[model samples]
Structures are given as structure tokens and as C-alpha cells.
Target: LLIMFFTTGSFADKIGPTDGNIVGRETDTVTLKFSYETSNEYILLYWYKQDTKSTPQFLLYKSARSANSERKPTDTRLESTTTRDSTELTIRGLKLSDSALYHCALR
Candidate 1:
């Protein structure tokens, strides 16, 4: 699972996906990580999954001062976390078909 970059022409070092590969077993866990330096600005973070057979899936969302993620279909398998300067999207109970292209978009 090679790491995927999900960003565009933004200011230097504002948002980036880590470079490397992510490998995990079925039912195991994996995290697609991202780092950001927002300079105390508030932003909405989202993680998405797009596979060959389905449309883009809205997995989770996080924003400033929010303790919980607003997930689509109320799924517990996917969730996101945010701190002062970074965020992570964790996939619990991974499956074989879960391997696909993922993007971490910020707004």
C-alpha cells in the first residue's frame, strides 16, 4: 500500500500526506496520517475512500473544539482524531477490499 498524496497548490507545508507504504492485515488496523500547521486557524478535515466498485465514501469529519467525528452511516469502523497541529484517520477491522486510494482533504 503505497502512500498517496492528497493536496493541491497550497502554501508551503500547510498540508501533506506522509510518504511511505501502509500495510495491514484484514481485521487489523491502519492509519492514514496527515500533518498540518494551521497557525491556530480552524479547518475541517475529511478522510475519503474510493475504490474500483464504489463512489467516494465519506468516512469521517473533524473540526475545531469538536470532541467527536461526524461520520456517515454512523459507522464505528472509521474515525478521525485531531490535536493542536496534526490529525489521523484510523480504520479498525480492516478488510481485503478496503485497500484502495485514499485522500485527506482539508477545508
Candidate 2:
């Protein structure tokens, strides 16, 4: 998947995902990792999950400097963290329905 992230002065560019799918079992925690390059600018990271053919559902987001993150009403088990060059989405208590297309966005 392509993740569109905003650049300086309102420009945007698309970054590619690290891989395709993450395999997991019921009640197991799984992590989806994304690797992307960015300049020395403020960045906002986002995480979402899309079921089957549905829209991407919001999970959470965090800034480059802030430790606090925000999640959607339905995002009870989703959390996000970032490193210098990568972002990770950690899902707890996996279920069969958790199988879906996961995406990460940056801005």
C-alpha cells in the first residue's frame, strides 16, 4: 500500500509499505512494521485497519515528539510506536476477524 505523507510547505509524497500481510493466531499479539525515510521535519504517524473491502478504519496516531497518541472509538486493542526510521502497530488479543488489510499513514 502507498502511504501519502505531507512534506514541507504543503507538498505530499507517497511512501510504500514494508510488506504485505502479518500472520497471527487467536489471542496472540502481532506487530505490523513500516519502514520509511523522512527528512528533519515534524511528522504525524497514523495506523488503520481495513476489513475485506471496507474503508480503512482509524486506529491511532502520534507525533514525532509527543508520546501521547489518539485512537478511534472502535480501536480498543491498537497501539502505535515509532523509531528513527520505522513505525510499528501492535495489536493485542488477535481474533479471526482481525484478518484484514492494515495501513499506515504519515504526515
Candidate 3:
């Protein structure tokens, strides 16, 4: 028996908050923008906070390509806003976890 795997070409670009200079109190909220490009394939968006190690932990938010598909509920500390063509992730209640190199990946 033989098994094979398929992969797609996709990339994400940080549109906002690239300065990495978040100006706000802990009680305040911060918003970040991201853009992604894929080969007409389904895309998934996720957020994470860098830990002591070189790895990100937890899924702050997520979205699908289909409107019918159930949308991922935004956490009380975070929220996401998207457009008809591009994806925009807005995080709320800026917390320590909200601070990190946010990335948008297409699957």
C-alpha cells in the first residue's frame, strides 16, 4: 500500500499592528489586521501568543471560507472582523496572551 499527501501554496501578510507597538492599558482593547493569499483553497485563520519556548499556544480565533460553515465564537477577550474577500482579525480586551507575533495561515 502507498500513501500520499497533498499541499497547497498559501501565505499571510500582517496588514496592521506590524509596528509591534501596542499603545493601550490592560483594560483597553487592541486590534490587529492580517491578509492571506491561497490557491483558491479553503483558508483558516488563527491567533496565538508566544510562550517561553519558540511555539505559540492556543487558538484565539478562527474562520472558514464558507458562509454556511459555523463561525468560531470570539473569546470575551478577543473578537474578529472579516470582509467579503479578505480576512481581518480584531482582538479585544488586550491581554498578555494577545501580545505576540500574530499570524494568518491558509490551509
- Measured on C-alpha atoms, candidate 3 has an lDDT of 0.47
Pairs in steric clash, model 1 = none
Number of the predicted model whose TM-score against the real structure is largest: 1
lDDT of each: 0.68, 0.64, 0.47
Candidate 3 least-lDDT 10 residues:
1-10
TM-score ranking from best to worst? 1, 2, 3
Cα-based TM-score, every candidate: 0.75, 0.73, 0.58
lDDT of 1 at 49: 76
Count residue pairs with overlapping backbones in model 3: 0
Candidate with the larger lDDT of 2 and 3: 2
Which one wins by lDDT: 1 or 3?
Answer: 1
Better of 1 and 3 by TM-score: 1
TM-score between candidate 1 and the true structure? 0.75
lDDT of 1 by residue, 1-107 (tens): 33344653246437777655587888888887787766546567777777767766776678744344455426678778777666787878888777877767766
Q: What's the distance in Å from true for residue 26, model 1?
A: 0.7
lDDT of 3 by residue, 13-101 (tens): 22223334445556565565545444443445555545445565444545546532324544655566655345555556556544455
Q: What shift in Å separates residue 31 of candidate 2 from its native position after superposition?
A: 0.5
